[model samples]
Target chain A: MDRLVESTRELLWERGYVGTSPRAIQQRAGAGQGSMYHHFSGKPELALAAITRTAAELRAEAERQFAAPGTAVERITAYLRRERDVLRGCPIGRLTQDPDVMADPALRRPVEETFTWLRTRLAAVLTEGRDRGELDAALDPSATASTIVAVLQGGYVLARAQNSPAAFTEAVDGALGLLSTASRTPRSG
Target chain B: MDRLVESTRELLWERGYVGTSPRAIQQRAGAGQGSMYHHFSGKPELALAAITRTAAELRAEAERQFAAPGTAVERITAYLRRERDVLRGCPIGRLTQDPDVMADPALRRPVEETFTWLRTRLAAVLTEGRDRGELDAALDPSATASTIVAVLQGGYVLARAQNSPAAFTEAVDGALGLLSTASRTPRSG
Candidate 1:
């Protein structure tokens, strides 16, 4: 990973899109202004690179969960069960809260694409489970996929608001319960 | 609403709790430094007033939808259907995204209270329906209430990420559908 990309990621995590500045990124990266500008046109260009790189990593991480050898239920449950710092919120979802990021199409494109790709990928995984008879054939894979994503994102919001991770866990648990309950082939109570 | 309080609310909305400054508020409110200090000791007082006022309005809005004359399904559905600037996100939920707001108990009190109050109020309405045979007695009203709120907050995150309202509506529709499906008490299919 390039130093500039790493610096942008750090700035993004700390100051957010609105608060971050190009000069700050250059200083953080240990690169002079010319060196920074040589690699990217400006802050938007640098931000796009950082956001896309983050998006790729997110996909790869999710793929690890999706590709795990287990029942569809086992895999998805494992995916949701990944260790996360619930208090910090999702880096991608956190950008949604920043007005500047949302206002800029260049920045928003990667964020939008990431979630869109995630939902599609998740739905595909669910579809395969339904096909293999691991999940209920009656389940709406796409809808369930959206619900899964919503629970995670919404859990962050609830947890952040309360300044406790309890709400995040509850929401996740509730969504998982829904999936199991709604499963055509119930495993066990 | 005093000039200072009004200014505080507007600034909180635009700059958020962390980004807003006393100097900016005074400038926007067209008040002198001494006059601003005279009305409120500092940012904390002004912010508390602003947050409290915002919470009250948010509750009133929810009550308007939840307390409307209709079946329980109708009322819940109405609440979900209420028009919103999905892109802008909920004013209360917006506070949750602010690090400073969540860190300070003084700042977080209204936000915490707002969601707590919303969940309680929603649960009460749900419980009423359970008693009246409009909903399943087996339903966990409080948990379901929390999930509904989560969906709205998450919808805002999705919408902002996409730079469009589509994801927000999809999330809302998905949650509302869950509510409909969960209703053991029959509604027209």
Candidate 2:
């Protein structure tokens, strides 16, 4: 049972909800029909568990970077610098592109929750910075938080399309540059 | 035959390359296997036609906005303001998420060519602005061009994940704000 769920997670990350097949999961997990069926009703039930697990793990890792002691700038920079396979699409973003996953609310909830938590976490960091006068007071924390998350997700898409990690690096650097600009007060000199 | 190809183009845009299947295309196109195979070799061939067709159209639409008569900033601002269904994801970005598509150069060429052409096209416009003294000579045309593409691609990911268009808007606004700053010469009191 444990192995079946674990294997689904790996396959989900690699193949997405639509591309993955029940046969693939059964084969990868080394489980037969009886074993998989005993643990769950079917593929959808198994996938739900896998998505929930991945979402939790992703959020925990992101929280570590955001919770680090620093102003919003350092924490976000740290999050971006956290080494990633730039050419690989984000697991969560990849799921959104999966027509099957997006169509089924059962499968979509975990994905929605994961990103929701991430945006909130990122927004908190931005809010803290704004309150401390470390970020421009006019900066909308929620909107800015959404943008940060979008840039990283979008960066992966661009990098993969170009077949070069340079695209990802340039995009991230550009985003971080925006952060630096916000930290500096604009006053008529 | 033409109807099948057109159906495929619409399917690719909505469901992505991998998410789409021959059965779906045929079903949507109201064509049978014999009709489809007579028109193209197989799924990949049909997909290639659809993808290439889409890439050409996307480029034409983008060029229309970028090449409009105006200062570079005005043109780019219009390009960004162009109405888009952000949560649906870019047709090209959807291709990037497909591992099968990325692994095959023949399938990948149209996508690659589209973005490359887009970046260069945008750069030329920016360069023109620089030469005309509409934009600061200090601007790096290539970097800014990549930034523009990244923000739109990334904005789609954000919008899709959050299930809100606000994130896409925020990211676009943020990137535009940066471009606006870049266009302005350094302030002197």
Which candidate has the top score in TM-score? 1
State each model's CA lDDT, in order. 0.81, 0.81
Q: Lowest summed lDDT over 10 consecutive residues: which window, candidate 1 chain B?
A: B180-189
Report the CA-based lDDT of candidate 1 relative to the real structure.
0.81
lDDT of 2 at A43: 86
Residue A110, model 2: Cα distance from true site in angstroms: 1.7
RMSD (Å) per prediction: 3.3, 3.6
Task: List the pairs of residues colliding in candidate 2.
Answer: A154-B154
Distance from true location, Cα of A80 in model 2, Å? 1.4
Encode model 2's per-residue lDDT on B38-132: one tens digit a residue: 88888899889988888988988998998799989999989987999777768877788777788889988888888889879988998898898
Is model 2 an incorrect, acceptable, medium or high docking prediction?
acceptable
Candidate chain B TM-scores, in order: 0.93, 0.91
Task: Tell me candidate 1's fraction of native contacts, as a decimal between 0 and 1.
Answer: 0.40
Q: Which candidate achieves the best DockQ against the true structure?
A: 2
